[model samples]
Each structure stands twice: as C-alpha cells, then as structure tokens.
Target: MDGVLVHEERAIPGAAEFIAALRRHERPFLVLTNNSIFTPRDLRARLHAAGLDIPQESIWTSALATAKFLSEQRPEGTAYVIGEAGLTTALHDVGYVMTTRDPEYVVLGETRTYSFEAITKAIQLIESGARFIATNPDPTGPSPSGSLPATGSVAALITKATGVEPYFVGKPNPLMMRTALNRIEAHSETTVMIGDRMDTDVLSGLEAGLRSILVLTGSTAPGQVERFPFRPTRVVDSIADVVPLVTELAEGDADGA
Candidate 1:
C-alpha cells in the first residue's frame, strides 16, 4: 500500500480509509514487493514516515528472499554486487563475502551508485565463469517522482557485456512467492496480489496460482494492458477501488457459503 497508500509523500485519496476498512474487517494482507533496495524494516519505516501506519513485519522485500536463496546456495567466495546497501548487507548477513575481484558469484540489484567500473568487473567475472545471480528482474520501480530503472537494467548491461544471463531470485519467480505465501499462511486460492506492475507483481501471483489485481497508480498505465500477454483478473485505477472489489468478493463468498 505504499504508492497506492501514499503517492509522493502525500496520502492517496481514500487510501488511509481503505486501510482502516481492512483493519476493521480483520482481513489478512501482505505488502509484497519486488524492489530489493529496502529491507522489510526499512520499508516499514519509509511507509510510516509517509504517514501510513504498518508494522515492520507486515512488509516484505525481494532482498530478503534473495538473501535466503544465496544462503541456501552456500556461496563461499567473494561476490560482485551491483546493488544498494540493503542488498549488500543482506548477502553479507547470509554468509556470502562481497568483493569486486576474482569473485565466485556476481549479484545484481538496485543501486544509485552503479558505475561503469562495477559493470566492467561484473562482466569480467561472468567471463571468468563466476555464477551470476540477480535479486529480481524488474527493470523499473515506481515512486512519487516517476518510474526509475532498477536492477534489471543493470542485469541487462551485464548480459550485454558478458553474454551471460543471470538467475533471478525475486518476484515472478516461484520461490519468492512461495516464501511470502508461507509467511502469510494463505493458500493460492484464498490470496490476492495487488500491485501496479503486471510483469512482476501480477505475474508472480499467476505463477503462484493466486488471484491478481492490477492498479494503474504505478508502472502500468491503462493503454499498456493490451500489449501484455498476462492479464489480471481485475483491473482498478487505485487501491481505493480495491477495497470495494474485495468487499464484493467477500460478500459473494459469504453468500455462497
């Protein structure tokens, strides 16, 4: 409910009321995000700073899932990371060493400090047979300002430089979705994914067999829907619309029951 909850540090129309409605009804929901720049705690703080009240545990970021995947892979050698502090810290916390030379793996995510030197070293590592891993494949992230290029843009740069495609560990990938679903304890049929991007958020839901809703407030615009192969079950203009749709669905379920 970040961008939909508050746009550009200003609360969206009826967003606070919608959240209040959810709290009043005791509906279970999770704010799942493919952006790896922030940890769950960091995201919660940012949202709170924007005046949207949410607990730290109520938020999830792709960095958390990427850390989990890296931990399981047991990457012992140095890793070339092209991401922000959150991604670097997550990887280091999971026991993976970080470096720019003779690395065992190259991990890519979002960072404002992305440099040509880092890209050059990453390509060299990939050429030297270092495994390439990406936190998420999202090329863009939404903000109050506008759409910003994300880790996927850097990933593409690495791909062009080295001709090697990295394995993605975030949303639209089943592993991350399964992780979030497990945390929420919601089955695919009972869960709904709400987001602004169709490729990452909506597709992740589809991959996990959950119902998906696309909102126009973020990366996706109304006209672009026709160009994509994957279509959301329902399309709304904003999170305010989502509240009514969810209420309708709840009533229908009750009637059927």
Candidate 2:
C-alpha cells in the first residue's frame, strides 16, 4: 500500500483511477501492507486523505495476518506484545489475551518508538518457553528523515539474546499471500499481485501461485530487476500503466461470461 498506491502520504499518479477501475469492474482487491503500526480503519483514513476511496475492509495489514495466524494456531492465546494499537487491536478482535506473565507467545511488530524495556521483557519471555512471532520481516521502515529500525531488526536482537528466531507472518513468507487470498475468497490463479518490491511483494505472490506486476513508484528501480534471481510476471513504470490492464481484463471476463 505504501509504495504501490501511495508514497508516504501522497497518492501515486493514477492510483485513485486504478482503484476506481477495480471497483467499476467489481474486482476483489485489498491493499496489503507489512506495516503493523496502523489498523485497517486507520489506513483507510490515510488512503482517503490521499484521495483513494478504498473501504476499511479492503485494507489488510501484517497485524491482521499475525492475529489470524495466532487464532488459527491456538485460539484464545496469550501474548506479550511490543507494538501499537494496530497489533493490539487485531489480537483483541481474535480473542487473544495480552499479558506479561508467562504468555504463550512474544509478539513483535512495528512502532515508531521502540522501548528498550519492552524488548528486554520480550527476550525474557521467549527465554521462559514462550514462542516468538513477528508481524513482518522488514528490517527497516521509511521515515521523513531516513530509515527507522523495524520489527525484523528488533526480532534479530531478541533472537541473538534468546537463540529463538521469530516466525514472521508477513510478505516473502507466501503464507501471507495465501492468507490474504483466503481473506478475499480469491483464487490464486486469477489474482494479480501488483506491488513495488520484488523481494517481498513479487516473491510472495510468485510463491503463492499468483501473477505479479512490479511498479517502479517505490523501492525497486528498473535496472535493479535483473539483480534478483526471480522476476515479476511484468514490470511497469507505475500503477498508471496498470489501469488499462484492469479494464482489459474486466472486458475479457465479461466477454467470457
């Protein structure tokens, strides 16, 4: 969502039009983001502010995926979380109890301010037999000044201290894409994952048996595509280029119907 639709707070050129095309075509779509700092409602508002009229339910975050994974793995589980409202809210909705006393898991996620005390507590909890989970494997996140240390970086610190690596539930896992497809009741064969990064977005989509389109509006550059061992199904200059594809696909679907 960050790179594909909006870069920071500003909407990418034709992002709104692309979303409109999807809606016009009645496409099942969701804005997937590895950032667990904000809830879907929060993200929806952010998108609306950027002139994209995406619904709240159409936004999926790593926080939501982690919560779903935990609920499925162990219902009504307990966790010691070190994140903001997004992670906490998702867990709460999934009947997860948050605590510091011998919790079943130590969940890490994205937050602007990483508390040293909280990290210490998470490390101690994992040492005491609690499993470790993280929302995403992103080592750093974008900021106005520069890159800020994210969940993966903090998870590394805990792993070094406790010798227990966390199970990340976000992109590049392929499970992330599968679960997202499940959420929308969409088939992988028909789904197209349009994203800006080859490493996370494209790789996860490819692994999940979905076609991927890489856009250059974010982290990846045109020349950098060959550096990766794998490639996206297609590489476009930006989301603007995909608008016509959406129309073309929708027309084909109608014709087939």
Candidate 3:
C-alpha cells in the first residue's frame, strides 16, 4: 500500500482512479502492508486522506495476520507484546493477554520508539522460554530522513542476545498472502496481487500461487528485478497503467453476463 497505492502518505498517480475502477467493477481486492503499526481502520483513514476510498476490510496488515496466527496457534494465549496500537489492538481482539511474565509468545511489531528498556525486557522474555514471533522480515522502514530500523532488525538483535530467531509472519513469507487470501475467500488462480517491491510483495504473491504485478513507484527498480530469480506476471509503471486492464476485465465480465 505504501508504494502501489500511496508513497509516503501521498497518492501515486491515478491511484484513487484505479481503486474507483475496481469498485465500479466490483472487483475484490485488498491493500496489503507489512507495517504492523497501523490498524485497518487507521489505514483506511490514511488512504482516505490520500483521496483513495478503500474500506477497512479491504486493508490487510501484518498486525491482523499476526493476531490471526496467534489465535490459531493457541486460543486466548498470552504474549509479551512490543509495538504500537495496531499490534496491541489485534492481539487484544484475539483475546490474548499482553504481559511480561512467562508469556506464551514474545510478539514483536514495528514501533517508532524502540526503547532500549523494552528491548532488554523482550530479550529476557525470549531467554526465559517464550517463543519469538515478529510481524515482518523487513530490516528497515522508509522515512523522510532515511531508513529506520524496523521489526526485523530489532528481532535480529534479540536473536543475538537469546539465540532465538523470530518467526516472521509477514511478507516475503507466503503465510501473510495466504491468510489475506483466506480473509477475502479468494482463489489463487483468480486473484491478482499488485505490489511495488519484488522481494516481499512479488515473491510472497508468487509463493502463494497468485498472479503478481510489479509496479515501479517504490523500492524496486527495473534493473534490480532482473537480478531476482523469480518474476511477476506483469510489470507496470504504476497503478495507473493497470486501470486499462481492470476496465477490460469489467467489460469482459459484463459481456459474459
């Protein structure tokens, strides 16, 4: 979402129009994000602010996926959570108890303020026998100033201290794509994933058996894409270029009807 739809909170060219085209054609789609700092409602408002009218249900985050994963693992289990409102809220919704005392899991997510004190406590919890889990494998997040160390980097630090590697539940892990597919009841053969990065978005979608489209408005460049062993089903300038394809689908479906 940060790339394919909006980059740095600003709507990319023709992004809102593409969304409108999808809605008008009744296409089922989701705005996927590896960031676990914002809830669906929060994301919805963010997109809305950028002139895109995506619904809350249409936004899928690593936070929600992490919550779902934990819920499936142990219903109402306890975790020592490290993150912001999105991660905490999702865990609470899943009936998980957030604590530091002998938790069932040590859940980690992206946070702007990664305190040293919190990292120490997290390392202690992991060393004490709690399983480690993180939202995504991204080592850093983009910011106006530059790249900021993300959940993955912090997770690496914890792993070094406790000799425990965190199980990342977000992209480029196929688990994230599969869960989002399940949430939308979408079939791999029929669903299409549009993203801006080759390593995470395109790779995850391909591993999940969905057709992936790569856009050039973000981290991945055309030259770098060839370096990757895998490839997306299609490559476009941005979401703007996909509008014609979507319109074709709408027309085709109408004709079939």
lDDT of 2 by residue, 138-249 (tens): 9888988989999999999999999998999999888888888988999999999999988899999999999999999998889999999999999999999999999999
lDDT of 3 by residue, 180-222 (tens): 9888888999889999999999999899999989999998998
Angstrom error of the Cα, residue 92, model 1: value is 2.8
Candidates, ranked, lDDT = 2, 3, 1
**What lDDT is obtained when candidate 1 is compared to the true structure?**
0.79
Span of ten consecutive residues with least summed lDDT in model 1: 1-10
RMSD after Cα superposition, model 1: 2.4
Q: Which ranges in model 1 have alpha carbons more than 4 Å from their true place?
A: 1-3, 75-78, 142-147, 248-256
Instruction: Point to the candidate with the largest TM-score.
Output: 2
Choose 2 or 3, whichever is better by lDDT: 2
Candidate 2 lDDT score relative to the true structure:
0.94
Clashing pairs in 3: none
Which residue ranges in model 2 land beyond 4 Å of their true spot? none
**131 in model 3: Cα distance from truth in Å?**
0.3
**In candidate 1, residue 176 scores what lDDT?**
88
Regions of model 3 farther than 4 Å from truth: 255-257
